[model samples]
Structure formats: structure tokens, C-alpha cells
Target: MKFTTALITALFSVGALAAPSITKRQDTVTYKIHDFTERKYNGVNISTLFFNIESPPNSGGNIKFECAPFVFPTGKTSSTFEAGHVYFCYKDSPYSFSFVPGDAQKGTWAKLNLWQTDSKTKTYVGDVEFREPPCRAAGPGKDTVCEAQEDYQIHMSVAGSPTEK
Candidate 1:
């Protein structure tokens, strides 16, 4: 009876000592606005390639999508960039902002292998391509700041956004 009581006491002591050491892994990231896709038809891109995303420790993360674009005819060049804001606690599974099913980015979404956090690079390169929808009356025109560009092909790695943990 005495031995049994001693064992129980020791176990409780160990549990109390070890409980405080375990911690949940947290990943924090921040990305800023860079430039638009490197294509001629990118006139339709929402000025900012993507919004600033910051997945904070406990805020369930947050995303600020800047779905804005230039109002006038803007020539295509890597140099053209808009002054945008940076947001944190944010986060896409699809090529879609709609999340309907097939990404409306172009009606199709191919899961990129670079979906991993370790896949970070200065510029993520892939032979990305998408279908093209000719400019129709209901849509943008040939030089009208409204063009259907398949922008998934090349990704610029310009520190694309400075992110950290």
C-alpha cells in the first residue's frame, strides 16, 4: 500500500514539471505588394499582384485583398508599381478569390507544387499557362485596360514580400 502511494505522488510531480515546456508551433508571414504579372495582357490584373497577408499567432490570420486597378491606359513593364499597404494576420487554395470550385481566375486551377512554406524563393518559376478568353463586348478590349492574361506562368521572386516568423 505504501509503495503504491509513493508511485502516484512521483507521477504527479513529473507531470507538473513537464507540462509547461510544450508549445504550439506558430508561423508568421508578411508579404508586400510588388508588381503585376509579366505579361502584355496583364492590363486586367488588379494593380497589385496580391494583397498583403499576415497570419498572426492567434487571430486566425487576415487578408487584405486590394482588388483595384489602374483607371487609364497603363503600359506593360516590370517597372510600373503602385504604392500599396501591407497587412498582417492574413492568407488561397484555388486560383480563385470566388472559391466557387474551379478557380474563376480563368475557369481552371492547377495545384502548384510550390504550395509549401519551404518553397519560398526570390522568384518562383514554373511553366504556368492558362486558357485565353478573347475580349468580347461584355468584357475588356484590345488596349482597354481590360485584357485576359494568363498570369500563372511566371512569378517574380523580388522578396515578393518580406515575410518573417
Candidate 2:
């Protein structure tokens, strides 16, 4: 009976030791507005603009926008935005962001065109493509440095009054 109890205690200790850490590594990336316009298309307010990027801690040392275009349709008109805010967060490493439309625009989204640079020569680091959707939920045990997936969330709002249109 004592031997059985000892074995059980040992097993419990091992299980406890094998548990993953609960603490998370968090960082924020900010993109500032370079330009924006408020216009009325039909009767709806449409705002589009470009933004400059500020580098995050682990973002290949510097920040620069890649030349990938995004296409979207608003009601009867199709609009293309050359630039806007691109916010990204990573747990272990490797992250991607794809745009998702709000309640007003359904089935409309954009994918970010991203690339890593040489850090010195300011050249491309091989070829890195953005593949994941923005603000998607992440799973457990995914917050590792060697893993190629990370979780992210987004918070956004219109800057002007509704009556301005």
C-alpha cells in the first residue's frame, strides 16, 4: 500500500512539472495615418488612407511597407487602398494578417503583403508572404519560438462624427 501511494505521488509530481508556462509575451505595433479622406459614396461614408509603420521589437529590426495591393468592394463600387494601419502581434514568432470586413461589408477582406529585409542592405529576406487572417484566435501550445503561427486581435474605430458625411 505504501509503495502504491509513493508511485501515485511521483506521477502527480511529474505531471505538475510537465505543465506549460502560463505567462504570455506581448508587444504592440503601431501604424500612423499618412493620409485619409472622408467621402460619401451613394449615402454611405467611405474613409480610406495610407499609413507609415513603426517597427516592433522583433520585426526584423526595421519597419517598411511591402508593395502588395489589396482589393475590396463597397456596395456597387470597388475601392483599392494603397495603405492603412497594419497591426500585428506575435506569441512565439512568425505571424500574418488578413483583413476582415465589419458588419457593413460582408465577405469582403484583404490580405497583407509582407516581406522581411536584409536589415543592412535594406533588401528582401528571401520571400515572406502573409497568409493568416487578422484578429484570428490562437490555440494552446502555439506560443513557441520555433512555431510558425501566432494569435492576434484588432481594435479599430472611425475618427470623425457620423454627421460629417
Candidate 3:
């Protein structure tokens, strides 16, 4: 009996350590976009809001987005948008984004697909991707190579609506 109990406890402890931590934020929370390395991005206007590279000094802080209920263009009502989705408001207008895997050509950079947020039916605006600088060897004659490590990751900040403040 003692052996069995000890084994079960050990297994549970290992599982807990292996599992990734998850955070549940309110729907009205405000968040900022960043690369996996936690490098902040500036909102460069391409067609919609684009965060390609890290924010430069004196360029202000990171651009923020909201996770709030959106009002349909029909003005019928406001409802919570889809899960795993974020809404970015630019120039008093809201836009949505989706993540897509890169092709063989663009090895590490992932595609960020944009959507026009007005009506319930989303309009396919376009897509933008963040390309990292080419990876080089860390030091003299080493097998290890320091490659670009940007991925589809987001960091949330304070609580607020999708309005850019």
C-alpha cells in the first residue's frame, strides 16, 4: 500500500511540473503584442496595424489591443467574438487577425492574416509577416546556430475595451 501511494504521488508531481501554465483574463482586458522573446513591436501602418520589428527607442511603448465584445456592422447587437482571436482598433476602426503557418520559402516567419471587423461577415483584407534577421553562429567554430525565434504569441496588459487609448 505504501509503495503504491508513493508512486502515485511522484507521478502527479511530475505531471504538474511538465504542464504549461495558463492564464485566464477577462474579455475586456487590454493586451500588447510581442514576439516569443518578449520584444515589443510598434504598430506600423501597412493597410491595417502591423507589428513587424521591435519598437525603437523613443518610439513610445508597445501598441495595445483589446479583447472585448464587438458590435456587428449591422448594428444589431454586440457579442463576444470568437475564441483564440484578438481585435485591434485603428483610427476608430476595429480589425481582427489570424495566424497561419509559413511556407517552405519563409521557414521561420509565420503569416499574420488580417480581417476587416465591421459586419458579422469578416472581409479578407490581407496578410503580413514578421521576418527575423538571418541566424549566425554564436561564437568561433560551433555547431550551435542562433536562429530567429519569433512565434505567434501575445502579451496582455491592463483592462479596457478595444479602443486605442
TM-score for each model: 0.20, 0.21, 0.26
Per-prediction CA RMSD (Å): 17.9, 19.1, 15.7
Model 2 C-alpha lDDT per residue in residues 1-165, reported as the tens digit of each score: 999999999999765433322222222223221111222222222222222233444544233332212332223222332233332212221222333222324444333332222223232111112232222223343221111133221211122323211
Ranking by lDDT: 3, 1, 2
Which tens-of-lDDT digit does each residue in 1-165 have in candidate 1? 899999999999765543322123323223222122212234443222232222233545332223222222342212333323221111212111210112456577322211112333322212223343233233344322223343332232223444310
Query: Candidate 2: what lDDT?
Result: 0.28
Candidate 1's C-alpha runs over 4 A off are 1-48, 56-107, 110-165
lDDT of 2 at 35: 18
Screening candidate 1 with a backbone cut-off below 3 angstroms (N, C-alpha, C), the clashing residue pairs are: 54-89, 54-90, 61-89, 62-89, 62-90, 122-157, 123-157
Compare candidates 1 and 3 on lDDT and give the better one: 3
The number of clashing residue pairs in model 1 is 7
lDDT of each: 0.29, 0.28, 0.37
- Could you tell which candidate, 2 or 3, scores higher by TM-score? 3
Q: Output the TM-score of candidate 2.
A: 0.21
Could you tell me the TM-score of candidate 3? Answer: 0.26
CA-RMSD of model 1:
17.9
